[model samples]
Target: MLTPSKPFTRRCFPAINVKKGVVMVGNATTFYDGDQKQRNVTDLVEGAKKANVVLEARQVAMKIFEDYTVSWYWIIIGLVIAMLISLIFVVLLRFLAGIMIWVMIVLLIAVMGYGIFHCYMEYARLKGTAGSDVKLTEIGFQSDVRVYLHLRQTWLAFMIILCIMEVVIILLLIFLRKRILIAIALIKEASRAVGQVMCSLVFPLFTFLLLCLCIAYWAITAVFLSTSNEAVYKVFNETVCDYAGKTCDPETFNVTNVTRLCPDATCQFAFYGGETYYHKYLIVFQVYNFFMFLWLANFAIALGQVTLAGAFASYYWAFKKPDDMPAFPIFSSLGRALRYHTGSLAFGSLILAIVQLIRVMLEYLDHKLKGADNTFARFLLCCLKCCFWCLEKFIKFLNRNAYIMIAIYGTNFCTSARNAFFLLMRNIIRVAVLDKVTDFLLFLGKLLVVGCVGILAFFFFTQRIRIIQDTAPTLNYYWVPILTVVIGSYLIAHGFFSVYGMCVDTLFLCFCEDLERNDGSLERPYYMSPELSHILWKKDAELLKSSESQS
Candidate 1:
């Protein structure tokens, strides 16, 4: 049985190569499939998943590609309705813009007038008999006239001169009207672009209600912290408390801190028993509520993202073809997200949350190692941190695109992600170009919105301040309004810009899908909305009639 060249067959992987007599191929890592071909579980699963995704993608392509009625009656009716609505909206927007411009001018004038009034008060106050004893309550807690006693005529003179300088600067702005007009022109263009997809942003108005819930929850959490910290410290005395061995008071224990209040014998005898007090308080004060917030927050984020994706996808389909655009697709999308995709949304969100948690932990570790003196060690740690940070960002981008596919194809998050990733990889260069362009435009739009809002809010706030300027010495950090304006502008800008961003992403996906499934040549036309195809590929639109003929 044994020849010189013969080798004995021994045990292969028992798990993978189930049959003992079968020769192990390669490293014996693969098993025979139903077709008697060597395959791995990963390969099998991926095959099945990708197959489903392809089918789902085909279903989307079919629905969007199908030819609809070109009947004259529907066309005329839709056009007339759209034209009327457009005219009404344009007129209303014009009126609103005019009103807002005038309102801003009036507010600016009022702020300047307050400055003039403040100058007058300073002038009068300096000349008064009690001028030296005039209590400047703003200066300090010495509101008993000592602050006023320190007020000099030179200070008053300086204040008056400052007011005059401000007035002069305002007057000088007339010479810069041309520059202002140019800026306004740019703003107008951005606003027009924003308006093109603003309809898609409507759903965010309702979804913001969910954001409100998150805010309320945070407020409650803050109150709990303020309420709990004090009570926990005052109610419980510093004792040899260890609940695991039943040494600590049961009544004092919070559920999250059960381990602390009821400690194991090991911790009870540890030298670090003193650390337990703070650890227990941290559990009661922070740990319990934080995890609950994460769960709620994750759900909210998932639902919000799905809603946005669907709205944008519907908009992408309906964008240029007003006739094909349904009455309100946001409602349809919300219905789909809530009814069909809730589970997938949850699954995707959980993965995102896990990655986010790891990133946070890494960040904490990064902070802990702040002063690490070993250069090589520091470099290695930095590289490790950078790797994970980039990974998080990449995952976020992938998930966003995946959600778009989910909205369109109604696939699970994992399947959608795989489809999106593969499609992107296949056309990486084009995707890169499109992504760069979209991001730049969005950044500019956000800048325009935030800059304008901040200026408006600043003037409005200043106009509301009393004219006396007596509060200058006590002015709330001088930058309070600036800070408030920046934050508010950022939030509003994000809300508006997010919709446009979604539109770009959704449209790009649709465009890619169109290219893949349909030959844009004459006999095989694009499945994209009529207006989109015409506008994007102007000269080629003549192919439409031929496509219809073929169909």
Candidate 2:
């Protein structure tokens, strides 16, 4: 009944009882079949479908792995090209910050405009065609997404969305013109700081390695825990009986009282389970394993953030460009973060891990309830999931800035988080506009790198190019290598650009502090770049000049 390997045709026979005359045991006879078995048609069909799906998935996975093995060298080349492009982009930002920022904005607008035009053309072309006038609601949802493309409403909706986006973007640029200038200045300043500390760009690799180790440890422990259970056998029968689910020894079951009372009953293997204390609480151990994985992964990321923040903070607070900076700032920061702030990092990581664990639990609950019909329960689960998602994001944001503060002031996690929170709140306007704009620009840079590398990979893997089509390795599915290259390129680009982002965030926080704690006097001169100071505080330019001249 449980496996398809021992399939057999079912048979039935009537049984005679001494007191009850001819007993109706045909159903009972079908239960313990030495040669045949009975099963529900629906269940059998479902089992076959599931088996087919599993087989298909395994085949696809094997093919993808084979393709990856064959195309590993090409994927490496693409990722290396992505890395070089990312590095060159960051270097060029130092000289062309404003020009690049404007160019990115223009390109975004042009892309949206083209999308609108293309949608409109498609909508026009679909007009007067058979079945094009069908309403989406009438046809309902389709498994194939391309079916929707034949409807005119889809193109109309796309055109409307693109038009709205294009208009909103143009208006935002017009309103935030001055803030964009400040963002460009910040990007320029961040570029200079990154230029000073070149080693920071490679820090993410260390974090990635640490995270991989954590994953490996967790995966191994989980596998061992899962396989630690013993086989469990139970009494099963087609007819109602007293020993329907009681534990039994398969070897000794035939002589037991259960078989004596119920002639058709049989002892069958149910699942992997045990009565031992360790096996009883294996779930708790797995939960602990997952929680530790989250904690360690977050700790690795937190360490990297603190290390980068310390390096860039040194760059910001230095009175002289490179003279006052430490000779090995990145290494010095690394040492300090490890020596003093390990506990604080652990504390922050623990908080984040707890929230993430709760989110995971909520997701598990949601999955379990998918077959349930309780509307209120589903609604509550949806709300909880949404809330925990937002909470995780907020905690991550808070922890990032808090780590920056810890790197700068050597405070505990709670104290650093509090200080960082208030610091950003005090300059909420700048936080809202300049910080996000700079982050958006960095995101665009990563996208640009990913796009360039992804296009090249797509062409090469699909053998679209004539020059190397014959040389590229053939694959079962060409998109496997293409996807690998795209994802790897994006990660490499994100790692490089994140360093620049951290530099800008550290400098911005330091700039806010410089404004509050220092005046335009020799004793408390600002440590900000001249261009940024000019853009933010035009009236103080004369005072800054006087302070500089006197010094």
Candidate 3:
């Protein structure tokens, strides 16, 4: 009998057969192309890896493999030890997230319960129903009191609905919590480890950089304000204002009310959302607001992204081989990112800017073209704009992935993007599942954190306001503290969630490389992680069994 076979790793097998360095079992290039049963290249690459074969020839690829396979005996020992230690930390954080979720659920329930109590209180207070014929003046309470009562009714109804929505969302999270935890299990643990690196290394460096940026921005603003001819023009000239106006300056620099007030709808206010720079000096304010400040903000954001991406990628790199953990991985990664990938970040930002500019043009054209009489022309314009809009979003996503790849490989933007795109295409379904699951879990975590904070603020401030059983007299103003708590909680949650998201992206890229490059056959094997090993182990087993049965 004749049979076709594929590579599958077995611990007892040799890495290289004596006959040739390359092991040949069958025609490996040919793949069946049935839509119903077509196997993915990622699976095939993964299958080949199981048999301990190297398909890639890049030096960087081998470097990554060597990093995983270094000091084999000690590496295994280190992994065992690290697993024991990491398990404790993982459990602690996982417990925290779980406890937070339950707290949010309870808070939502409390809000609903409070609303129900208030509804009964209001109903009980109504002694005698007034007829529709009764005048407003006939009501016993003052107008202010009546108005407050009406507002109270509205608030109770809104709160009840909101609380119900919150409860349903929390319940849904509870239902899917298990799957969500499993999906992000490894990444979450890694994030806890990465936190140590960020705190020790990344945060200080970034904060310093941010301070420098502020100083530089201030200096630049000063220069522009002094030199941008629009800022300082002599308005006191008799030719300009019949009544001598000395340099139409405001109490503050480059800000003043328009001396020549036009009709009702024409001139703008000096401060606030000034529609136009009606005042000459206001041009400086407008330029700073629209152009220089916007660019500086974008630059800072791009810088932060590059720095963070590099640090997270470094953590992933260190994680690939735990035995060789660097003492200063964060600093190491940051230096490399600044030196090598700054250009890549700039390139990505440029792409983003161009896409955004195109979007702005489309929006402006949309307004201008809305009144056009030709139906077919309008339809064409709409289609063109929609296409560009989608393209803009795709470019943004592509640019982000490119930055990750650049962080990993120290490659240029275009090359990194191309490689990342191809890798994703090869594992499209797997990537989609991981991306969606990870995003959902992180998002749920954010909502849980914010909800808990909001409720805590509500409980604290409500008690302090001295509620005397008549809706707290100041319950209407409780939003101030709640809103503040929510904003602060959102910022905190975002900080935590972003680290996890970056780790997920970095780890995924590492896994893609792991599946392609490393074969876990006993003679020359280093597994990605025990969790990942366990995942791939079952697939390897099933393949081996099938191949044997066929033979």
Candidate topping lDDT: 2
Report the number of the highest-TM-score candidate: 2
What RMSD, rounded to one decimal, does every model reach? Answer: 28.2, 8.0, 30.9
Over the stretch 1-551, how does candidate 1's per-residue lDDT look in tens digits? 11111123553332334466655655755766433455675664576678877776676444333312212232233334333433343333333433433344445445556556665675566665555544455454431222443465535655677577557645644653333332232223223333543555455556578767876896798665644432212123333443334333335444447555534322222112334445467645554465455556676766777776676566555535444544666667778999999888777767766666666667777788888777887687788778878887887788788888999899998999999999888767446445544454445444444445555444433445466334222222223444544565556556655665666676677777778877867776675655445444542243345456788
Sum up the clashes in candidate 1.
5
For residue 516, model 2's alpha carbon misses the true position, in angstroms, by 0.7
State the lDDT of candidate 2 residue by residue for 1-551, as single tens digits: 24333222343332121124433334432222333345344554577779877877788778878988999999899889999988887778877888987876776676667668878998999999999999999998643355788899999998999798778878878976766777888888887888899888888899899999999999999888887888889999987688999899998998889988999899998888877879768989999999999999999999999999999999989988888999999999999999999999999999999999999999999999999999999999999999999999999999999999999899999999999999999988678767897887787677677767876787788788999989899887777778888899899989998998888889988988888899979999999878778876752354356557999
- Which consecutive 10 residues in model 3 have the weakest lDDT in total? 262-271
Q: What is the Å distance of residue 74 in model 1 from its true position? A: 50
The order of the candidates by TM-score, greatest first, is 2, 3, 1
Query: What is the TM-score of candidate 3?
Result: 0.56
Per-residue C-alpha lDDT of model 3 across residues 239-310, encoded as one tens digit per residue: 323334434343442233444431111221222322334446655474444444334444555556555666
Alpha-carbon local distance difference test for all models? 0.56, 0.84, 0.56
Give the worst 10-residue stretch by lDDT in candidate 2.
Answer: 11-20
Off by over 4 Å in 2: 1-48, 107-171, 231-272, 539-551
Q: Name the regions of candidate 1 deviating beyond 4 angstroms.
A: 1-199, 215-292, 318-320, 371-380, 456-474, 521-524, 529-531, 534-551
